[model samples]
Structures are given as C-alpha cells and as structure tokens.
Target: MKVEGVLVLDKPKDLSSTEAVEKIKRLLRVRKAGHGGTLDPFATGVLPICLGRATKIAQFILEGDKVYQGTFELGIITDTYDLTGEVVERRPVPELSAEEIQEVMQGFVGEIEQVPPPYSAAKYRGQPLYRWARKGVKVEKEPKRVEVLEFRVLAVELPRVEFEVYCSKGTYVRSLVHEVGLRLGCGATLVALRRLRKGPFTLEEALTLEEVERLQAEGRLEEKILSVEEALSFIPAITVSREMARRIRQGRPFSVSVLGSLVRLQKVARRPRVPWLRILSEDGDLVAVTYYPERFSGEGWAEMLRVFVS
Candidate 1:
C-alpha cells in the first residue's frame, strides 16, 4: 500500500533531519520522501516528513513560521553558535538585573540583519560553509534580513537562559542566540534546542521515531499519516464545482467570473482572505493549486504551479 501524507516525526537529538527521512523511507518502503525543513543534528522536535505524492505540499509547510524553545549558555561563544562547535571566544558576564536583560532582548523583536553561522549549510560559491569551516578557511558572508516576531526570555539563571521564539521562515535560532549574547555584553552559545511548532503542526502532535517504527512493525503506519490537504491548511483554499475541477484536470483554465464570485462571496461572508485556491475533483483528488491576481483571466489564467493528479 502506497502512503501519501505528512508524518510529524519527533526527531531524536543527534540525528540529522535527512537521516530521519531516510529511516522513514526505509520503514515505509517508499521511493520518495522529503522533510519540510532541516534541523541541526543537535536540535530536535517536530520535523514534518512528507511521503510520496505529499511531497508536492512540502514547500507550503517550509514557507510557514516556526516556534522554538531553547537555552543559551552565557559567557562563551562557539564557532557554530551551538554545542556542535568549539568555543571560539569567552567573556566575563557582568551581573545584570532581570529588567536589563529583558530590555536587551526587546531589541531583537523585529527585523534585523543576521550573519549565518560559520558552521552551517549556507553556501558560499559552490561549497557549504561547514566544508570551508572544517578546512579552517574564512569567507565573507552577506547578512540577511530576518524577522523575530516574538522573543521572550522565559527564565534567567546566571549563566543559562531559557527563551521561546516565534519567527519567520529561514530565521536561525543558533544565530539569534549568538546575537542576543552580543546585545547583553557577553558571548553566548546554544546548549540545547527543540522546535515546538512548524506552521500548523505542533510538537504535541508529533510522534517519536521509535513509535513510528513500532507502528510500521504492526503494519499500521498509514493510520498515522496526515492527508496532504490537511498538511496545507495554512494556505487559503477555494473549493470549485465539478465542472471547473474537470477543466482544471484537463489542463484548461476556468472562467474569470468564477474567481470574481469567490472574492465577492468571501467579502460578504467575511471569510478569511482567500488569495489562493486548491482545485479538487468532485471525489476529492487534488488537481492543481492556483492564485488570483484581480481577474482569473482564462487567456492567461490561474496557471497550475503543481498538478498532482490528472
């Protein structure tokens, strides 16, 4: 039996996200499997793995916000910003009041420039930064703009601080920890980290790899799978009639009036913004995904970015 859905794996620490995917592929005996996002081997938590046809929706999950709870050890800095690298620097941490620490953290709550960690997967030229770092080579890296929607220091212990972060895609928690330390006048390094949420999936809903293996042994793996449509719940969905669905399946576009009607109805019904639609057959097989730019002109209409089934 071929399985098509998302698997929210509770990744164990010390296993790269890719390694976890490989285990899932082997367990399920599926030819295709992809993780929504990559997690550092030292970090663990909710890692969504998509299998078979569900891989088509992996991009949607990757584009969503992520939440993490972790601790940063103060007074020491590592080359990788985490426990994986050697301490490159150490500084004396001055006695700071709770209010002062809170004030310093506030500065990181919005848009800011962040430099990728030297021991990271970021590419310079054609080689990964980690490869260069391993060779003791230094390369100039451009800073990237990343938003920190929420950054709160949950607990403060002299040399260790626990915090929760909610941020946009591509925001690196390791880099954030290093920068937060810079703001506090002391160096810092990530000692432990765990992702609590990724888009609509939460740690509460994730399963450990051991549990997945047990289920697979019992021949009940599919029972734990989440449908592709369910995994893409974060995106706006527009349901079409059977005729329109057929046209979409035939590689033809739908009428402009149909899209206008949806927009008008959504406005009157006070529905959440439906900027995009999921074209589905009457029996519920996903055909294509599309967006509207004013009028869904059939001449250059909603092009199918991904066509799942004919």
Candidate 2:
C-alpha cells in the first residue's frame, strides 16, 4: 500500500528542514513528500512532513500559525541574526530586569513590520538573499508586516534571555529577537531556537527520526501517518451532494450559492475568515480543496484548487 498522509517529525538540531524531509522520504520509501515549512539548520522541533496526496494540502498547513521558543544572547550582533553568522558587532551588556524585558516583548504583540535578516532565505530578484551575501553582495529586503499573537520573555539571566512567541506565518522569530536586542540598546542575536508548534501539529506529538526508523523496522510505519482529512481538520468542512462532488473531482467549480441550487450545503454556523475550505464528497472522502474568492468576481465560484480524485 502507498503511504499517504502527514508525519510530524521531531527534527533534530543541525539538520536543515529539507534534509529532514529527505531522510523521511528515504525511510518511508515514498517517492513524493514535502515539508510544510522550513526550519533553520540550528533550529529543531515540530516539522510537518506531508506524503503523497497530503502534499497537495501542505500549503494550507504552512499558512497556519507557528509557535517558537528561542534564546537571545545580548551584546552580540550577527549578519544571519543567529550565532552561526559572523559577529558583526559587540556591545556592553546593560543591566536589565525581567519586567523590563517583558515590557519590551509586549510591544511586539499584534501586527508589526519586520525586516528579515540579510543572510536569510528571503527572496530578492528571484534569488535568496543568502546567495547574494555569499558572493560579497548585499540585498536589502523591505520590512514586511507580520502578526505576533504572543511574545513573552520566559527567562532573563544576565546576557541570556529565553523567550516564547506565537506568530503568524512568514514572521521570522530571529528578526523579532534581533529587534528586541536593538530596543535594549545592547544589541543581540539568536543563540538557540526551537519550534514548539506548527498549525495543528505540535512537538509533543512528533516522532523522532529514531522512533520512525524503529516503526519502519517493526512494520508499523503506516500507523504513524495522519490521513489527509485529519491534516485538513483546521479548515472548515463543506459537504456537498454526489453531483457537486463529481463536479469538484472533475475540475468544475461551484460557489456556496450554486452548490445550494444543486443540493443543500451542510450548514456551518460560523464563517471561516480564511477562504480555503475542505471539499468533501457525499460518501465523505475529501475530494478536493477550494478557494472561495467568490466575492472577487460576479461568477462567485469556489475555485477548485486541487482535486484529489480524477
């Protein structure tokens, strides 16, 4: 049987996210697999691996919020915003209280503009900024707006401050830490980092690579796979009639209004702010994913994003 679903891997440190996915693919013997998001080589924790058809929904999973715990070493600055980069500068560590640091963290909560590190995967003119930086070229990326739902200083020990933050997608925690250091006037850089959660998946439920290898050896690797429907549980489900399901699976689009004309939509009390939805067949299989940008056009059709069945 083909392995198809999601695997939450507890990525170990010093391994890039892509490397982790490659390890999983080789271990599971699956041809198609991809990670939902990227984690820096120095960072480790919840890395969602989508296999087979689950890969199609990886983008939606990546769109979900992320939680990270990281440490900042004050009095130091680096080009990469982490310890691995060259120390660009050094400053004297100033006296700072836990309350003072907490106060500073509170200022970052909510939507704010952030500038990604120069030595980062941020794209500039169709190439990663890091590529340009390697050849003695510097590409300045513009500050982007990101939502910071929570930011708290877990601990403050002299020049070392540990923090935890829950932020929206595309919000670079390293940059947030860098900004906090600048605000303290002592300058800082990320010394350590770990991802605690990504969307509906968490570190607690993630299996380490060793455990996964053991499962494979025990012939129970498939047991670890989470079904496509479970991977999309965060998205609101919309059940349609056989006819609508057939249309969706056949690459035809239909809006909630049009679906109502064919057959009543399973009533969902609350509307989802995100336009993406889980399109389920009458028999209850996830047939496709849809985007309801219906409001943008007079036709108002739920654009068929990906069809699970041909």
Candidate 3:
C-alpha cells in the first residue's frame, strides 16, 4: 500500500534538515515529501517529514511552537552562532551569579525583538542572507518580533551552559544564544543543539532515519505512517451529516445552526481555543478544516484547507 502521513524523524547531527527529507524520499520512494521545520546542518532532533498527502498539513505543523535544548559556549562568538561557522571574536567570561543569569533570561520572556543572524537563510531584497555572507557582503537586517515563551538555563559549567527554550515559530535559538551571551557581558556561540519538541510531537516519539530504513526494508513502513486525521488531532472536530459533507465538497456553505453548541462553548473558552475545526463526513472520513471567526455571523463560512478521503 502507498504510505501517506507525517514522520517525526530524529534528525541526526551534521545532516541538514533538507538532507534528512531527501533521505526519507529516497527510502520511501515517494516523489512528494517536505519537512515542517528547518534544522541547521549542525543542529539535530525532531524534524517532521510529511509524505504524499501529508505535505498539505505541513504548514500547520510549522506554525506551531517548538521546544529545543542546546548548549552555548561562552567567551567565543561565531559568525553562524553555531559551531558550523568559524569563531569571529573572543572575550573574557564575566563573573555572573546564577541569579543574574536568571534575571536576564526573564527579560527575554514574552514578546521581544530578535535580529536574524547574518549567515542565516532569512531573505534580503529577494536574496538569501547567506548568499551575501558567502560573497563577503554585509547587509543590515531589521529586527523582528518573536515570542520566547520559555527560556531557562538548565545547567551552568563555567564556559559552557545548557539551555532549554520554548519559543514561537521563526524564533532563532542561535541568535538567542548570541544575545543571551551579550547580556551576560561575554560573547558566546552555540556548541550543540537538539529540538526536543514541535507542536504536539516530541523527541520521545521520534524515530531515527536508520530505524525507518529498517522498517521499510521489512515492508512495515505503513506501520509508521499515521493517518492525516491522527496527525491533526490537535484541531477541534465537527462531524457533518452526509448531506452537509456533500454540500461542503460542492463548495457550498452549510447552516451554522448545527454547530450552535460548539460556537457557544467556544465563546466561553475564549481565544486560541483551536479556532480551526475538522469537518468529517458522515462515514468519519476527514473532509476539510474550517475556520470560524469570532462573533461569526451565520453568513460567514469555513473554507477547506485540507480535504482527506479514505
């Protein structure tokens, strides 16, 4: 059987996220495959690879928050923030109390301005920043607002410190490390990093590329393929009658009165209460994802972001 769904790959270090997806494509012999989030070549951990129809939901996965555990070495700053780049500067480690470090970390919490690293994939004037960096060109970049939900120093060992961060999408941990080092009055560079979680997926549930290959060779690859519905379990669900499902498939809006209870309950639940809804056919097959805005007028309707038929 053809396999389709998200595969949480425990990306190995030294392999770019793209390379890992390529390996999965080659292993599964699937022409369509994409990763939800990008991991630097030197960074490793939970990289979600979507195969076949699962690629349609990759954007939603990418929009979710990510958690990472990494170690940053102080007294040295690198061009790439991580060890992949050469050290461009070095400074003496300033004497700082643990309490001081914690206080500085607190400042990073909530919404804050973050500047993307120069040697990054961020674009400038329709060109990748890395492209300019490789050509010995420096471009001034504007700082973007990124939320840092959690920033805790897990351990401190003189020049090397381990930290765990839970941040919004697009928050660069490499730039974070560099900024934190500057806050401590000492330069720093990311020495090692591993993503522990992304949205609903965690490292504990991830399978390595080697294990996936083993499964494929044994003709058990389907066992690892989660259904698209299972992958989108985080979204709220709304089961539609067969007639309503047909109407949806025909691109017609259904009566909102049927979901009256859901709307009322969601009003009390307030914002960020899974605004998206999973519309399922009477037979329990997923049809599409619908978005109902706040104070949703009965005239407003939910559009299908993804449609799945089993």
* Clash count in backbone of candidate 3: 0
Best by lDDT: 2
Q: What TM-score fits each model?
A: 0.91, 0.92, 0.92
Q: Is candidate 1 or candidate 2 better by lDDT?
A: 2
Clashing pairs in 3: none
Candidate 1: which pairs clash? none
Give the worst 10-residue stretch by lDDT in candidate 3.
Answer: 265-274
Writing each residue's lDDT as its tens digit, candidate 1 over 1-310 gives 9888999999999999999999999888899999998889999999999999889888777876789999988899988999888888999998876677778888889988888888888899999899999999997799999888898888888788888999877888998888889988798899999999987889998999899989888998788899887776655556667787777777776665676576566552222333456656666667676665555445545556676765
Model 3 error, position 50 (Å): 0.5
lDDT of 2 by residue, 179-287 (tens): 9888989988999989999988999889999999998899897887898888887776667778878877776757656644333345543344356667777688888
Between prediction 1 and prediction 3, which has the larger TM-score? 3
What is the C-alpha lDDT profile of model 3 across 34-149, one tens digit per residue? 99898888888999889999999997888888999999888998898888899899999877666777788778999998888998888999998989999999988999999998
As for candidate 2, its clashing pairs are: none
**Which whole-number lDDT from 0 to 100 does residue 136 have in model 1?**
91
Error of 1 at 170 (Å): 0.6
C-alpha displacement of 1 in model 3, angstroms? Answer: 3.2
